[model samples]
Target: MAAGQHFFGPWDYVVLVIVLLISASIGVYYRFTGGKQKTMQEYLLADKNMSIIPVAFSLMASFMSAITLLGVSSENYTFGIQFIVINISYGIFTPVAAYLYLPVFFKLQATSAYEYLERRFGKASRLAASLSYTLQMTLYMGVVLYAPALALEALTGISKVAAILSVGLVCTFYSTIGGMKAVLITDVFQSLLMFAAVFSVIIYAVIDKGSFDEIWNIAERGNRTDLLNFNPDPTERHSWFSLIIGGGITFLSLYAVNQTQVQRYLTVKDLKRAQTALWLNWPILTCLSLSTSFSGLAIYSKYAACDPVKAKVINSPDQLMPLYVVDTMGDIPGLSGLFVAGIFSASLSTVSAAVNSLAAVTIEDYYKPLYKSIFGKSLSEKTIAIQSKLIALLFGLLCLAVAFLAQFLGGVLQASLTIFGVVGGPLLALFTLGMFTTTANEKGSLFGLLCGISFALWMAFGNPKPPLPALPVTTEGCSSVFTNVTVVAEPQLTRATTQQQEYFWLYKVSYLYNGVFGLLSTYIIGYVASLVINKIKGVSTQNLDPHLFITPIARRLERTMDIPLNTKELSDSQEELNGKYEVNGKY
Candidate 1:
C-alpha cells in the first residue's frame, strides 16, 4: 500500500520528538505575546489587520492537513497515478474564488461571512447554512484527527484510541486558547514542518528506489502523467472537468463563504491586500498538493513487486498505506519520524481551522442573537470572547467522539468521499442565488436552500446504506488461490476476482463528481426559482439595484467606512443623522 517505503528505523522517534518541540515552541510564543488580549474581535478575528502572506499561508495550511496528505497518498497507492488528476482539479479553484465571489462579502465588512446569506435571503437560510457548516467542519476535523492516529498507531505501537485523544486534546487546547491569531501563526509553522516531512519522504524514496529514470519509467508505464487535463468529462468522475468544476465550487464556498477562510481575509488591511494574498495562494497550494501525489508516487515506486505489506496483513485498504510506511520506511531512522510528523501537520492545520471557525459561528450567529434578545442589550467584548472558548471546548469534544466513530467506517478516502455532496451541493446553490440574482428574495432563498439541502442529503445517505463490503478471506501474503483451487477441483460458487474489480479511473471520479453535481444542481435550481419569484411578483429584474449584485472593489472603497444602503450615490457627504454623518458611519 505504501508505494516506495525503503526507510523506517527506531531513530524515527528522535526525529518526531524534535518536530514536536518545534511545533510546541510556537504555541508557547503565541501564548506569551498575545495572552492578555481577549476582546471578541481580537480573540476571534485577530483584529482584522492581517496581510496577504500570513493569511494566504494560513489558508493553504488549513486545506492541506493529514486527511489530504494521507488520503491522497493512500489513493495513489491503491489506484495508481489517477490521484494526481483529482488534485490538479482542486488546484485551479483559487482564482475563481478571487475574481467571481470575494468582493461582495469583503465590501459588506461581514463578521459572519454567511451574513451575506441573511441580507440577500433571510435569517432562517443564514442560520441553516452556518449551522450546517459547523456540523460539517466538526465531522471534517474529526476525520482529520482519525487519519494520523492510524499512522501513529502503526509506527509506534501506540493504541489508536490514545493517539486520537492525544492529537484532539492538544489541538483543542491550542486552538481554544490561541483563537484566530494562534491558528494563523501556528499554521505557518505547521506548513514548514509539513514541507520538510514531504520532501524527506521524497528524498528517501529517490535514494531507496533503483534510480530516478527507473522510477519515472515505472510511473509512466502505470500512467502517472498529465496533471493538467481540462475535461477528461464531468460525470466521468475524476476527470479534468470534475476536478476543475467540482474543486472550483468547493473552494469557492470555502474561500468566499466559509467563515474560517473569511476570518483570515478580514484580518487583512483591505480588499486589495486580501486579494493580493489570495492571488499568491494558488501556486503555493498547488505545490503542497502536488507533494502529496509525489509521496504517493514514491511509495509505489519503492514498494511495487514484493509488497512487504504482505508481512503484516490488514483487512482495510487504509491500513495498507500506513503499514507500508512503518514496516518499510522504518528501515531508515529520522526519515520515518519526519514523514509521520508530516501527517500530523496535515491534521493539526485542519483541526485548528475548523475549531476556530466553529467557535466564530457559535458566538456570532447563535449566542449573539440570544444575548441581544434577553438583555435587550449588547454584551461586552470580553464576554463574547469567553463564550467562544466555551463553544470551542464543547465542539472539540463532539468532534473527538466523531473521530472515534469514523474508525468504524471504511478507508479514510471513502469516508470523506461518502459525505462529499450531502449538504455542500445545495449550500453552493443557495449562496449563488443569494449573491447573484435579485429575484432570489426571501421566499426563493428559503425554498432553494431547502431544496438544495434535501436533494444532496437524499443522494448521500439515501442510496442503499453500504455496510462495509466483504473482502475475500485471506492469509498474510495473498496467493491468489483461485488459480490453485480451480486446478484442483471444479468451483462451486463463482468468486469475485480481477474481473470483479471496479475500474481504477472511477476511484478518482467518485470524489470529484459528487462535488461537481452538487454545485451544478444548486446553481440551475436556484436560478430557475429566482425566475419564478420574479414572475410571481410581476417584477422586472431591472428594478433591483445592480450594485448590490455586482459591487466593485474601487467603488466600495470610496464609500465611507460604513456599508451603505442601495441608493443613488450622493455628490455630498455633508448630510447628518442625529449628529452622525450617514455616509461616514458604519452600518
Candidate 2:
C-alpha cells in the first residue's frame, strides 16, 4: 500500500471527468442528429441500419459489465485461473446463438425478444418470459452499477453514494437522451476503456514482477494456475465439465435470446451483418474475459507473499484490483484515473444497455399490450416514442436504487452471474422449446418456466451452503508497520465438516450448474407437460410458420411431420420474404 497512497490526483480526476463528459456528449449528439430518435424504431433499434462494428461491440459490452472486470479478477485472485475455461465456452456457444437463436429473432424483427414467444406459442408465454427477463436484468444491473462504486470507495475515499450517483446518473442521462444509437456508439468507446483498465493492471504487475512468465510461475506455485480439471462431479467447483457445459448454456442465454443483445443485432441492415456482428462478439468477449482473468493472476503476484485480506489491507477480494492500482500505480498521473474511468465505462456500457432493453421490453410486452387491451386500440408511434424515453429514465432510476441494495447480495461476480443462471436458463429453455420442438404449447412453457425458476432459486439460496475454499495465504510477510493490527487466521474447513454436509444436494451443486439445472428442468418438464396438455385438450399444432422454428428443425419438421408451413400468411413480395420468412429463402 506504500507505492502511491494519495488516491486520485489532479490528472486522474481530469481523465475520469473527460470520460464521463464524452459519454454524455455522445447521447446529446445523437439526440439532435438523423431521425432525432423520435420514432420507436429509431429510439430502440437504431433505425435498424447500424454498422457491424459498433453493434458487435455493443453486444459484447451489454453483459460484460463492471461485474466481469471486478468479479472475474477477484475470482481468479481468490480461487484460481481455472475460471478462464469459461471463455472457451463463449466460443463454442457463439454459433448456437448466431445460427440457432439469432435467426429466429432477426427474421421476426421483433423489438422485444419475447415477442417471438407470442407469435410461436401465445401471449401468455410471451408475457411470462418478458417478466422473467425484466427481473433478471433489474437484479443484474444493480450489481453492475454497484461494482465500480465499491471500487471508487475503496480507492479514492469517496462515499459509495456519491460514486454510485456520479456514474449512474451520467449513464441514465446518455441512455435516456441518446437512445440505442447513442448506446451502440458509446459502447464502442467504453469497451476500449474497459480494455485499457484491465491492461493497466497486467502491465503494472508485469513490470513489477519483471516478466509475464514470472507472474504465471508465481501463480502456479500458489496453486492458482490450474486451468484443466476433468472431474465429472457437478459439485466440484471450476471443473472443465461445469465451465464448458454450464458456461456454454449461460452464453447462449445471453447472446442468442437476451433482448439487450438481440436488439443490438437488429440495429444492422441485414441478417448477414447482424450475424457477422454476433460472430465477431465471440472473439472480443473472449479476449476481454481471458485478459481479465490474467489480470487476477497479475494482482495475485503482487500479494502472493502477504495476503491482503489476511493482513486486513482490504475487506473483500472485489477490492483487490482497485487497491492494487492505487497502491502500485497511483504515483503516475492519470493512470489510476484511467483505470477508474475504465471501470466506470464498464458499468456505463452495461447499465445503458439494460436501460434501453428494459424500456423496449416494457413498451412491447407490458405497456403496449395493456394499452391495447384497455383502450381498444394502439397508441401512435410518436406517443410511444416519448414514453419510451421516460420508461428508460424510470428504469435507470430503479437500477440506481437497486445499486444501493447490491451490497447485501455477496460477491459481484457470483451474484450477478447467478442472476443470469437462475433466470437465463429457463428463458433459454422456454425459447428453445418453442423454436426446437413442435409439440411445446403455451401453457406448458409457462409451467416449466415457473417450475425452473422456483427450483433454481431454491438451489441458489435454499439452505446454508458450505463455503467455497480458496488458495491458502499467509500474513507472516506483513511488515512491523502494522504490528498492532491483529492478523486473523483464515478459517479452515476440515474433512469432518467437508465430508458430512447437511445442506440439500441441489444446494451443494456448483453455482455454474444452476443454469443447467434450470434449463434441463424447464426443457424436460415443459416438453412433457406440453405433450400432456396437447393430448388432453386436442390442441391443433398445424398451420404453424416454418420460419418461426429454428431453420434446421423447421426444415426437418416440414419434411417429415406433415405440418403445414403457413407460407401464404406471409405475402409474396420479396421484401416480406427476406424480412420475415427465413425457411423460404436464406437471409
Which candidate number has the best TM-score?
A: 2
Off by over 4 Å in 2: 2-6, 480-501, 557-587
All candidates' lDDT scores?
A: 0.64, 0.84
Candidate 2 local lDDT, 483-535, one digit each (tens): 34466676798888668657677777989888999999999999999999988
The true-versus-predicted C-alpha distance at residue 29 of model 2, in Å, is 0.6
Clashing pairs in 2: none
How does candidate 2 fare on TM-score?
0.93
Candidate 2's C-alpha lDDT?
Answer: 0.84
RMSD of each: 6.1, 3.9
Instruction: State how far residue 553 of model 2 sits from its true place (Å).
Output: 2.7
Encode model 1's per-residue lDDT on 1-587: one tens digit a residue: 23322344557877776776666666666655764556777776777766578788898877567766677766666555555554454456665667556766666566787776665555777798898787667767777788888877766667779999988887777667666776777777778777776676677677877576766676666565444545555334355566566666666666666777787888886767888888777777878777867777776665554333343334345554566556555666686788777777657667867787888888778888888999899888777777788888888888888999888655686566545455566666677776665556656566666666665555554433423322122232224311121112224665653244433332323444554566666667667776787687775443232333445632443353453543323213213311242111112
Task: Give per-candidate clash totals.
Answer: 22, 0
Q: Which candidate number maximizes lDDT?
A: 2
